[model samples]
Target: MSTNRRTFLTGLAAAGGFAIASPAVLGQAKPRVVVIGGGAGGATAARYIAKDSAGAISVALIEENEVYQTCFHSNLFIGGFKSYEEISHRYDALAKNHGITLARARATQIDRDKKEVVLSTGARLPYDRLVVSPGIDLKYDSVPGWSKDVEEAMPHGWKPGRQTQLIKQKLDAVPNGGTILMIAPPNPYRCPPGPYERASMFAHVLKASGKRDCKIFILDPKDSFSKQGVFQEGWEKHYGAMIEWLGPKVHDGIKSVDPKTNTVVTGFETYKDCAFVNVIPAQMAGEIARSAGLAPAGGYCTIDPASMKSVVDPNIFVLGDACIGGDMPKSAFSANSQAKVAAMVIRGELAGARTFPARYINTCWSLIETDDTVKVGGRYEAKDGKIAAAETFVSQPRESAELRKENQAENVGWYAAITADMFS
Candidate 1:
């Protein structure tokens, strides 16, 4: 850690009075802030609060994993373009250097009336303000014949880590010129262009393996998808017949899957003998959010747009994929932007300043091929009691090779800087 960062953290601890003279003396009163789910949104919020609060807020971060592997570039790993280690990060820096109390445990429930969070281990954390950003959990039971037991046979690989590796291994072990099946969920899922990008990556691997006959079949519930025009053009120009996309109206898509037989059944037909399958089921807010009574009927948290505070409980703020941001796609970039705004709002509230309306920025990039990338960016403003897109900063199709390369490099730089800002 840098000397400047250490000095900043020390000053924050002194201001917040979080540093204890001894372990026994640590049980005194303090303005506690508990953050659930240490992913992009939660981690960024925690880092900012710990760094900028100047000891006025004591932040505790709860996450199940000690190390986090990003979902953003996991498709590249599946496509054989990158390794798992390339996208994984540890939280030691945040704990040891940033003065954050990192708890590696799942949050069990929230007692809103008591202003406390209960962990699975039975420890209760009292907080003046709480933040939830657990991301999404797959709704496996939504799709008939697909259950948690079938995960070993056909992985979703949506949340990153071992499931991702399992799918990649299956793809690698498949026979040359074999077929890979990808089941894409409906709208309002994480990463709008993710499934298509996964398909493109798989096609790249097949092309490199001398398996020109190999095919990637995308069974999508929606008739249209993000970056559709750019993806279609890239597919035709690069992979051509190697990639097949079946929309809901045409193929009826996949209603269910039989893991025992390795068969995917659509309303119109059934596919058999699939070498590998990635069934990305529908999603909802993480379990902790739902348990806390923060989630609404749509399985996402409802928050006031101005303060990012829970509608059911004012002391709690929800952001990122767990919260319903009007008309915003759930992406890491979007999460980071929301975190910054939420942090600012929370800080102002803590400092006893009047809260202002929130503004957000979103930029999503999808890598169609090794050298081909597509991007979309926009700014959002809260208007008429709902957040809406105010301006499109950059939403265009990829045309030139130079632009694609530049976008790819920019995407990498963004991943590095954002992650560093959060954990480092």
Candidate 2:
């Protein structure tokens, strides 16, 4: 290893974030860890803790759903690149291979004072340490005239699963020369690049079906979005005049929506009888996380960058979209990377295992068109009590076809690798 790597390892060895809880030394039973919301972060943390501890720690993964549907690649499914089953994963591998106990029940409450998790079934689970990775939840009133009840008519496929399927069906039902509208979410939401990719998917499907006349309009609330240069360039090159993006400055923000008539009233223009509409409203941390007192008024938990432990309660770790990950965007790759650091720290403390310094990395890949993909990524480390970017890179505009194709292949491979890291 290099000198800097050695220094990091030395620091990890010298640090005692949590007291060693070795059962032999303390004359106690194996330490039990409970993880909530088994998606990207929770699943990986539970599996790593169980596998690394080698029965020194008992792990329970409490998730309401037996199968996890990923929000990351649901856009590809909409574009007909993947199927619903392809993006779905099960917890069978974590249980059979890593000895993780899977509980298919929702966690209703987090009793931090008692160090217990109350489940929806009225059972309480005790944890020596708790890991929570509940993902984003929609703020229905964030959009004018939009609420949870009208989601079936105007679907926001942000959470994945049935909503994702609903959006795909709406896209498929649009006729040639039909109008499709998407109200993109505001800042600091889950997946900075997701809304743009979904728009690309919409154009891709319509263009493929020779529905080039079908109009796709994006009413964006933000001034600029992730990878705006490349995404806009790709849209002009592949699906010219088929997609139109109007920022807040141009549209003067959304005035109201008539869900019954599939209409949107904007300051500049009123779009009526839109064949398809996707209204992704503002979002916050999931309800369970807020209820646990892990979040403040910001609706996200501040975590210690070195350990992914919640700043509010040292005994609890918050991961994924629920935590305020300074530089790391809310993505599966970021969550999975953070989980490794958390698992190592938990193992080092409770099982007396070796520890390593935390290094977080993330790359968000967006597929623009056939064999055309772009990505933005960075390496982050804890510095001055917060995560900061050490190195970063993004794909430039008008790249070579061969290089873009390679990037697309990389995106596909990463999806496979990350899902395996989380579930298997």
Candidate 3:
């Protein structure tokens, strides 16, 4: 094996040894693994552990909602490429097919010392191992002049479900020649490509709705964004003069927002009387993780890149957007990939299953316009104690129509496969 690969495997073996040596409670009939959150990370981890264990371990999945509408494809729903039902998933199959227990309650707290999850329904669910995949919680007050009370007027739509539909409704209500201003979040946010995709989707809706005069403005705090070239090309070709992106250099910085007046003041200029505003503020790990003292400094849990086990507590694993994933972008595919690693390590530690070296894969696809999509992804390995990128690929700008269409197909196929992986 290569030097990096050898080092990576050695780290995995050492982490596995540490997990195996973790103190276990006595007098248990079956080792119980409790997973928090039912999104891509927690759902995939729960399914894998339950299925691969083959009745050797019990898996309990704790989630607030029974039906999950994926944030990954919700942009397509906003663009009218997919329906709400297409992005929605239920956990019934996970219970029936995989023999996993679905606990339909919000996780209020994580008792690290007691090894239990406190639910909103005043129940304590004990576990030998805890998998926390509660995705990001929006910092509503992070953006100036924005807060939870004004969210209805200026929707974030970062979390899937009601916000997604609300944003779609707000977009539909925009009059012809109206303006929509979207405040993109800063760095280290979930789905690095998301804000740009949402802008594309918004443009798609306005263009297809015969509102050619409608304009969408993305005020980004970052200098550049994911698939910038491909998205720019597609926007220019399809929505010509309909979209604008103001980087920090151009916008200076967001000064303030007035929800009642539908106005936003930036350091350089002020946008007045906007028809709609998407204020996606800064984000951090879900509230449960923060409340549990799992997130120390970065507002995210630090985990061993080799095993996805928390550096704070070896028995608790963090997945998805809640953990620092080294080089991995906080996307559903990355979460699902990390979930498998956590499941493998958990099985190895608790069920005496053989373990292998950790290898992670992620592909993020963004639909630029109808039948036009771009992708970026890579294979990753634990190197130098971080999940470092090994091999990477991305769609190029000015690709042929056929190639873009094929990429779009791949995007659709991946959504189906991943949602099935998580919920089915």
Best by lDDT: 3
> What order do candidates take by lDDT, descending?
3, 2, 1
Pairwise lDDT winner, candidates 1 and 2? 2
lDDT of 2 by residue, 1-424 (tens): 9967885767565554345334442355788899998988999899899988888899999999978899998999999999999999999987999888888899999999998999999999998889999998899998889899999999999998999999999999999999999999987889999998999999999999888889999999999999999999999999998889999999999999889999999999999999988999998888888998889767788899988999998779999998988999999889888999999888877776777778899999998888899999999988788878899999999789999999999999999999988888
Q: Write the per-residue lDDT of candidate 1 for residues 1-424, one digit (tens) a residue.
A: 9854664455455334422333232344456789998888899889888777767668899998988999988988888767889889999998777689988888898888988889888899888779999999899787788888998799888888899888788877777778788888887888888889888988887787887888788988888888888888888888888888898888865667888878889989888888888888999998889877888676888877655778888678898888888877788877887887677666655643233346788888878788677887788866655567888744355589888878888878887888897789
* Candidate 1 off by > 4 Å: 1-29, 353-357, 393-398
C-alpha TM-scores of all predictions: 0.90, 0.96, 0.96
Which lDDT tens digits does candidate 3 get at residues 1-424? 8976776577567656755566463235789999999999999999999999998889999998978999998999999988999998899998899899888899998888899999999999999999999999998878889999999999999999999999999999999999999999997899999999999999999988899999899999999998898888888999998999999999999999999999999999999999999999999999998888888886888988988988888889999999999999999999999999999988888877767788899999999888898999999987798899999998998789999899899998999899889877
RMSD of model 2 against the true structure: 1.9
Off by over 4 Å in 3: 1-28
lDDT to native, each model: 0.80, 0.90, 0.91
Which 10-residue span in candidate 1 carries the lowest summed lDDT?
A: 18-27
